[model samples]
Target: MSTDQFTFTVSKTDGTARTGEIRMPRGVIRTPAFMPVGTAGTVKAMYPDQVKALGADVVLGNTYHLMLRPGAERVAQLGGLHQFMNWPYPILTDSGGFQVMSLAALRKIDETGVTFQSHIDGSTHVMTPERSIEIQGLLGSDIQMQLDECVKLPCSDDVAEKAMRLSLRWAERCKVAFGDQPGKAMFGIVQGGAVEALRIESAIQLAALDLKGYAIGGLAVGEPQDVMLRMIETVEPHLPKTKPRYLMGVGTPDDIVEAVRRGVDMFDCVMPTRAGRHGQVFTRHGRLNMRNARHAEDTRPLDAESKCAASNAYSRAYLHHLVRSNEILGMMLLTWNNLAYYQELMAGLRKAISEGRLADHIAEVKEGWAKGERDGVVEPIDDKAIAAED
Candidate 1:
């Protein structure tokens, strides 16, 4: 687990979905990995140990959030994010370009980077590609993303192409700023709106750099599911199969499944944690909103067959009570259940790919979601039967 080098090994492939491992100095990440967003150096409500225990090999840190709050230099003096957050695993740091658009106010973009007033305190700051890379390095990020402009949907072709070309140029600057590290990596983000030609052009240009990995950014912002999937398809053919392909800030269970089917190897999203805080948790029966009065008298666990205790041990009624009362335990348990569900989904996808039954697995997974929950006390699936399915 300890090394001064980074490498990716693919074990199996079923259509476009892959079962693989990303070996780094810190640890090995199992692919198609789901990284819980630990923005501002934490995964919000959950503890570090709990996040790792949910099968997360890595977690994401937000450069803009950390830089604005505790300040990046302070974190460096305090021993970097992993040591600061007590997560001794691989940490992928976003370049903050997305936030330079979403979180900052009065933003202005030029070749030098983004100049904007801080959303938190209205302080002025500039986040150039080099500066963004420097900030991530100061945080000692294991995997760093390059700075890129992400335009909202419905923008003109000229606007999209302009942003895409600028991002390609910045990707070069990031490479120079990142320099080299024995066990670290820098990934490029592709941006081109909804245009297939622009997506292919951006992908080809980024691939020419032959960076450690590549991410299809600028989707899931407002586009429909089919649009997002189409973009993935457009770019996948031009990307390097040997390296990892990531889809940033992407989505629901069905979203993840569909993206994986199109060859995306990594993902990071706030949906599970954010939804949990809102009294919602994912299950085989689809999303359950604990605030519903129908659960007030329900005694059955959210998913008695779930491997996570949060989902299998506590009754829906108790969860509903906690959520209704605004209890911290409600957030913690729901977040735990949601993360467990995501990890379970990833595990199933990996197994299906390895077993050459990805189609069957996908059909079963979708069917389970559509069938909804069973009535009364649900019987847990036996470990042996589960193994047989695998």
Candidate 2:
């Protein structure tokens, strides 16, 4: 892919935080962007229009899920993932590599590819690097990820080295299969488990391939937060500065902030949306559990100042009632609110980076979340009440 074909313009860089834009044929994705996961072609309870209304620039599709469910050929027959899903915005599709290793049963790894039984219905499937790229191309993805081997964290150094080497081989195959397209781009994944030397080796090998973008995969897979951050720090400097860097399947609000501080430009995770379905709501003041009894009598909105009606117009008591009663509307509303919150946070980070105040902005966010509040109003607990109980 030519540099002019898909452009990532860095408007400003404050420390490791950056504000930029990735212009593709489908649409423009703002940098430091958070892509809502639309695994299996939908964003769970929310519709595509509703997701766009929540201010998402782009959404992600899982290759393994789509390939197994409706099949890639079917999606192409139905007019690609964008039209099939009714989302006209840009979509990035993952290579089925992760699912082949993680979701499948009776897995066997070899140089040719991975062979495994489908978790759904116990069927069989084989996924190669070329096949993964072919599927993403069939889906007409704006951005496609390379098929790479992902080793579990806390593995032996020898195992980590072997996986990293295999991933490099797969990256080459994916790039060759992807060929050349004007707007479409393929991103290589950097996989080296927790070993810093292996991470550097993987980055150097993938950078030599000259792909459009690079993703730091194989982290946040149950590793401690500090170890993941250290791995990122080790690989960040090796990646090409002109191209975008993505961190796959990464984390909470604090994790996102920390990733930005370490020079990561893109992220995808199911945390907010998936967590919301189970009664967890993310706010400026940390995560709040709507299933808790404290919210049963609380009549305040989740966030009074939010522009999202789902968050600002509903009372905690009503939300709790819905969740407690197992109403489907509860999941819908919470998913919308959580997605809106994620987008709002990303917008703030972009603005802060462009203005050269990201460090201060991050500190302020940490402090605000540390001092948790309800409905944006802090309630002081009486110290005398505790003394009286004693």
Candidate 3:
């Protein structure tokens, strides 16, 4: 560990909104950070260097995917995930708890751990809180999440309470297993389904652990938007304001903005990249679908102001053709555009919070998206102009 040594220091605050940085051996991560999901060791279509250029301070990897495909031991043997994936920056790895429940089949959960068949090849595996820590350590992750049971939203009161309590016990075991890794930290996940009281209890218990950070888990798993916000509100006051707060698998540009206003610090979601693969791209004005027929003739960039070349250099008409033809560049460019938009949004939130104008900033962002439309017709790109640029 460096002098920073796995710490979060708050620089400024705006109501529930605040700005800060998390210091790790890998680097310093700006608060209100949006971490792109690098499932199975890559961030889908975008390369690691491109993801870095997009201003991301960190990225997330799934233990379930890596352990299933390449195996954690193999990754460790190959000089850890950073060398293996060519990403030298910080990486946060999930504990394999959530994916096991959601993706795996024939799952059996007990006090010790969960045993399930892999979704990929139907291979058998067991993931306990200790083993989850071991796998993350093998991957050399900077931030490691505890293996907590994530009950789906809308579970009965009895079931929610049961899972929440179980997760608390598992958190303790994960803490012990994580055991004093310098420059690295273990984060306890708060899981309580949609129950406000249960969410509070979970947060209270995890905060007492003096963990390096905390995460709001078991949400965005089919709950309504307001319900998820309510859960955050219920848990925020109970968590220590000093530790970094992560909202796991929760998302969208709007969701990130609202969650920042509610005191959450970090976020990881598949929405941006996943949407990109399907021809959807996000912009300051609004979202765009390249697969639409009207875009066949329109000639405009996704956003002229965006620093990313993909957003400013390529025209919508070109993107439309690529997506329509199922070209690989379509996925790459859109994924690039979407991730750039998310990182841009996070930067805006940080700046607004530091300036004590987060509320006004949030309103402005939403209004821009609400009042505009990307549907107006425009003349096609001139062949001569396109050829000259190329």
Candidate 4:
């Protein structure tokens, strides 16, 4: 039966790590899930159908971009983001807080909310907590985030505490604006920049709201990998276990795996797609620069053992040539391959946690990356050996 009220159920656990499903009227989202960034309703270089088939339960939309170009009301009139984009599944939309903060010199922050000049043009706009919720509602976002202040890392203790307090205040306003949406969810973002006390306080206070979910933000801005992981560790305990925990804008495959181990249930990032467009390929054998000279004469497929057609059908030499020539098809193929690999990794993590061997699975996955490539050739993984190890 389809659930009318948003709900999450944890089915398995390995240490602090967990595997679960978030059930809503539209669909079920598997965790530890990775949401691809579909900034302006479209995932760059890929079709919606392809995105669904690649194992993504949800794709993220940016409120700032959409509101600027197409406008939120326009999307609603056209039948919301799902009907407009041809994606029938759940969609999560950011509150535009991160993008607003990124505007730096172009924006001014105060108690009323952020006032910023649009990058698309010189027009000025104000995005209070209420306005952000209204935009998400207009776009029919299944999962919505509260507007929060996201400060860059290496900030002072005073700065982090101030941002955290403001975000907590905003969370309250966003909650009131998001009242009684049974079929949807409002997630409060925990922002403390890199401070342990501030992160804990943010998580505890947000969890007190008893919202549908929580997200750990403010870490991936410029901090070290260790610092990011530590923040996750610090915040995880304070968040409620029943609700989902999201690590916002998290990074590399290694970062995802480690964060999952630390108990994050959801994630979103532009790493795979962004890296793909730049001729970078992520694989079970680690990252490969397709534009490298070594691939120019190689004839092997990027990953002959994989199921994605782009990964299995194209030769390294052809891909290299396409990248070198700046072919559009090259970007398309590489983006497809990268998204496929990320989904594959998510599937592996789910399976590992279910079978109670996440620790070993993580070690093997890291070992695969450690074993990079031999003379520019990445040997195929043996499924039988992996199963036996499990």
The candidate that achieves the highest lDDT relative to the unseen native structure: 4
Off by over 4 Å in 3: 1-4, 373-390
Model 2 over residues 35-84: C-alpha lDDT tens digits?
A: 99998999988989988987788899989988898999999999999999
lDDT per residue (tens digit) for residues 98-187 in model 1: 888987878999999999999888999999999999999999989999999999997889999999999999999999888877789999
What is the alpha-carbon RMSD of candidate 2 to the true structure?
6.2
lDDT of each candidate versus the true structure = 0.90, 0.87, 0.90, 0.90
Window of ten residues with lowest summed lDDT in model 4: 381-390
Q: Count the backbone clashes (under 3 Å) in each candidate.
A: 0, 0, 0, 0
> For candidate 2, what is the TM-score?
0.94
Q: Candidate 3 residues 1-390, lDDT tens each?
A: 334489899999999878999998888899999999998899999989899988998999989989998999999999999999999989999998988988897899999999999988898999999999999999999999999898887899999999999999999999999999888999999988888888999999999999999999998887889999999999999999999999998787888999999999999988888878878888888877788888888788989999999999999999999999999999999999999999999999999999999999999998888765534422232223322220
Off by over 4 Å in 4: 373-390
- The lowest-lDDT stretch of 10 consecutive residues in candidate 2 is 381-390
Measured by C-alpha RMSD in angstroms, how accurate is candidate 3? Answer: 5.9
Q: Can you give the lDDT of residue 128 in candidate 1?
A: 93
